[model samples]
Target: MISINNLSYYIGDRPLYDDASLFIGPKDRIGLIGLNGTGKSTLLKMITGEDQPTAGEINMSNDTTIGFLNQDLLSYLTDDSILHVAMQAFAETMKIQKQIDEVLHEMETNYRDELVDKLAKLQERFETNDGYTMQAKAEEILEGIGFSTQDLQRPLKEFSGGWRMRVMLAKLLLEKPSLLMLDEPTNHLDLPSIQWLENYLQSYDGACIIVSHDRRFLNASINKIVEVSAYQLNMYAGNYDFYLEEKELRNEIQQNAFENQQQKIRQAERFVERFKAKASKAKQAQSRAKMLDKMERIEAVADEAAAVDFKFKFKVKSGRHVVKMENISKSYGDLNILSHANAHIERGDKIAFIGANGKGKSTALRIVAETESFQGTLQKGHNVTTAFYAQHQLEALNIQNEILEELKQAGSGKTDQELRGVLGCFLFTDDEVFKKIKVLSGGEKSRVALAKTLITESNFLMLDEPTNHLDMMSVSILVQALQQFEGTFLLVSHDRDFISKVANKIWWIEDHEIKEYPGTYEEWEWWYNREQEKKKSSPQPQNSEKKEKAKVAVEKPRHDDTQKQLEKEIAQLEGKIEALESEVTKLETELSKPEVFGDAAKMEKTTNRYQSKKAELETLNATWEQLVEKIG
Candidate 1:
């Protein structure tokens, strides 16, 4: 177990964490979450000893080993072979191997008993460390992280930034630390690589703490949620879904408690005011005033992020057949990426392009977007206006322009106020709209690009990993927007949840072939998992008297009870939201009072409560809508 005792970190006037304490167990699968600047990374750094806390300490077992996968892997990377970098994890074993090499060289020069004995000792150590098997392990991890055999031999410098991040991940996974901390580990992974990682981490015995914006990744891998905000750490004993539910419950309870306390405070103040002026009740009023002054007030809750309300409106209509391709083939030199791949996209078709890395998912998307030339009978319907959003679209934004200016340049044709409102819909408000794009974070830039896309009315959207760099809240909003998009879209994303919500068809790529699965992403996933189960458990059990065997490999049907439960929860959420709306109004009214201005601390608490309540309401509304959507 790792114990954090009253841990605190302060940078100048900013208190990232204050008096935070928690215990992490050996088998804990924790998802660390919060707003962008709420010290999630800082806390990880403190835990890993990369940075020191301003006060208190972290205590752990002496045998504990930590491995942290940073978001910026390129900073620490070298121009080494991918396989070589992975093998660096076995530092001790490599040292022993070097010693053995030196001893062997000495023996070749002078055959001495001492040299022979030294070599024998080194060899024994190497065998003890399982040095002989490390090469295979390195290669295995590299392959799991999406490096092809040929690619593993290539120098890290030859890969792009995303691929380099994968190489770094391979190194960290190979380390096999007792405690693993990953910051956005899936940010650069393909769908297959992500599934591979999910399988690996599901069976990982070490304590894992990850900070990622991927909601599906959190739900699949984490069993605990650690929320860092308002200079405090809050622990939730569940996954991301549970965390969302539990957080709302917590805020609701907190709001109730605050309301009760405020009620009592108001009563006491009234009593003090009415009696303090009368001589007969002056002594009692004094006692009441003192009691009121000494009361411990409940601090207001802090929101995770401001709400972003936006959606994409498909401005133009397209013909029935949106895109058609026949005998489509793409290759680089002698390497065939797409061998006569055939596919058809109809209007309103939501397609998810899934495949192993470098297996032509993006290539196919590029082909459809007409950004890459390929030998094929490709055709587009008449008046099939298109908009393409690349995975790295945010990187292509003009950083010199301000957020609002970018919107204007996109020809949104909205007034200044209208543009500000639209920007607010993506969590950009106030002075934030005037901020230069160069200074924005990756998430912010992605939101800007999305906002730009929203202003464009295109019937066909070729979006490649549109959710990249977005926070869970932003992702939820984007998913909602895409769900409402009345246009055909082809998406390339490793985010299973997002894909499941947005895509209605699956175009799987493998060996340069396009296998179209006719159904929603959820159906295709079920079919795929069922087949995988069958493949893993091939042989059927023998039956007596030639009895028929059960079809255990089939996907289990979702129980109707789950749907009923969701409905029940949805109804309950409506009630909670209504109650919360009332509470928010009360808080807002209190904050509006002129007397509140005199008490800066009270004003701050009230503002925080309002923000948190508002955020909770938005989340509840979103969840309720999603449940309703599933119901239909």
Candidate 2:
């Protein structure tokens, strides 16, 4: 058990906590939730000894090991494949394996009794550590967190910023610390990855604390909720939904008690005032006054922060057909992400683009917004004012500007008063509104992007993963505002809760086509569940040889004279790939050295080469596979 006894922390003049206490037991899956800048990360850091508490101590068992993922450090520096990092989680075990190898080598020549006894002890330790299955465990976890077999081999630098974080998360999970802490773990994950993480944490034997705005994830994974607000920490015994219920009840009790106390204080004051002036009751009045001074004050209800009411009314209502795409095809070189995808989005349609990450949910939105050029007849209806918020829109913000300045560019027509009002609604208070945009946290940045979307006042809002970093309250505010929004929106989100609330229509993007389904998220999910059940009940042949033959028949490739030439070239390419892979591995080892971090230019060059080689290797592998298929 981890006991946080009267913990207190301060940030400059601001006190984050006066005296906060929490008891974290094994199997305590706690959701650490709060608004932006409420010391959620700081609290975790204090517990992990990454940051010291201003006062009080965190008591824990001596044997406890902590595993933590820092939200601020999303970018990872490594030349090796993601698998290498995941494998590092078993660093102690890997070191043991190395020791075992050295022992075996020594045993080959030295037959001394002492050496044999040493080998036996080492062998026992190896089995105890489960060293044999470490590789399999690491691989299984990496796959579960969305790493493809090919992706596992690709250099860490080859992946985008989001994927790098996924690699980090995979490593942490593999570590299986006694206390697992993650801050906004679902921020960069897609739907399937988030689902996998929830399942992983649900079965996790150790105490887990996750700071996330992903409500569905919290509700599903956690059995407890701890709300940090107003320099106070409140614990609830159930999930997020239960927390809400308990919070409301607690608020009512506090409010009523506060009112009653106020009335008592008022009566006491009146009695003191009336008697203190009189000659006979002067001592009694003084006694009452002293009693009042020593009295404990009852706290009022938890003041809910002013929510951002995003009421974006379009300047002009678009035509009936807001967007029309006829056989729209998007390709990155030879990789056809979307091919002949046709869709017609009607005005006021709140559509959700749902699919796996690579299925082009964002691509379809970009096509609708006409931000990307595609090979198709993509038409916009009359007077369509479009605003697009990409997945990396927060990254594109001009960080030099203050929050107010940034919002000024967004809601150009609004007066300063109205602008401040909007900022306040989004939970940006007096000094916070003047804060530099660059200094904002992930959740804060997402809020700014959402604010910008509202400020643009476009009839067509195409938001790609808008809720990626938003907290529960922020999402609720956005959802409420969007519910009242007069404009049409196409949202690409993995959040089932967010989609279910705002999306009036569903655009299930699968393979290379858009399947427009007219239904709420609940209805679609019901149908999907039934479909899955149907597949489970369906019969299948047990003949292994027959199954293999059928699979080969379905995937067999044609061959000709061109295939013969390609096969010869394929052999040459394979040799080049092997050589390149060896060179890359050597470079990766060199890059991991501590001195490389000191040299910015050298790091940049190595990183560039690392990414480039990965890309080239990927291209070669794809070409080689094509050749092999043709030859077969």
- Top candidate by TM-score: 2
Model 2 over residues 1-632: C-alpha lDDT tens digits? 89998888988889999888889998899999988788888999898888999998899999899988876556667899889888899888888888889988988998788888888888888878767666756676788777777778888888888788888888888787899999888877888888878877776768999988888899999999999987878899999999999989888988999999999999989999999989899999999999899999998876785565546666788888888888889999977877888888888899988866777788778777777888989888998898888757888888999998998987558877888888888888788899998889878998887888777778888888888777778888888878888778898888889999998888877778888878888888888789877864554332233334434543556366665566558668767776676667667655554354224345456756776787887797677667655555
**Would you list the C-alpha lDDT of every candidate in the order shown?**
0.81, 0.81
What is the TM-score of each predicted model, taking all chains together? 0.80, 0.82
C-alpha-based local distance difference test score of model 2: 0.81
Quote the lDDT for 315 in model 1. Answer: 49
Kindly report which residue stretches of model 1 are placed more than 4 angstroms away from their true locations once superposed. 8-14, 54-63, 76-79, 300-315, 531-632
Reference-based TM-score, model 2: 0.82
TM-score (C-alpha) between model 1 and the true structure? 0.80
Q: After the best TM-score superposition of candidate 1, give how far the Cα of residue 147 lies from its true spot, in angstroms.
A: 2.3
Can you give the lDDT of residue 560 in candidate 1?
Answer: 71
Q: Least lDDT summed over 10 consecutive residues: which range in candidate 1?
A: 545-554
lDDT of 2 at 230: 72
Q: How badly does each model clash, as a count of residue pairs?
A: 0, 1
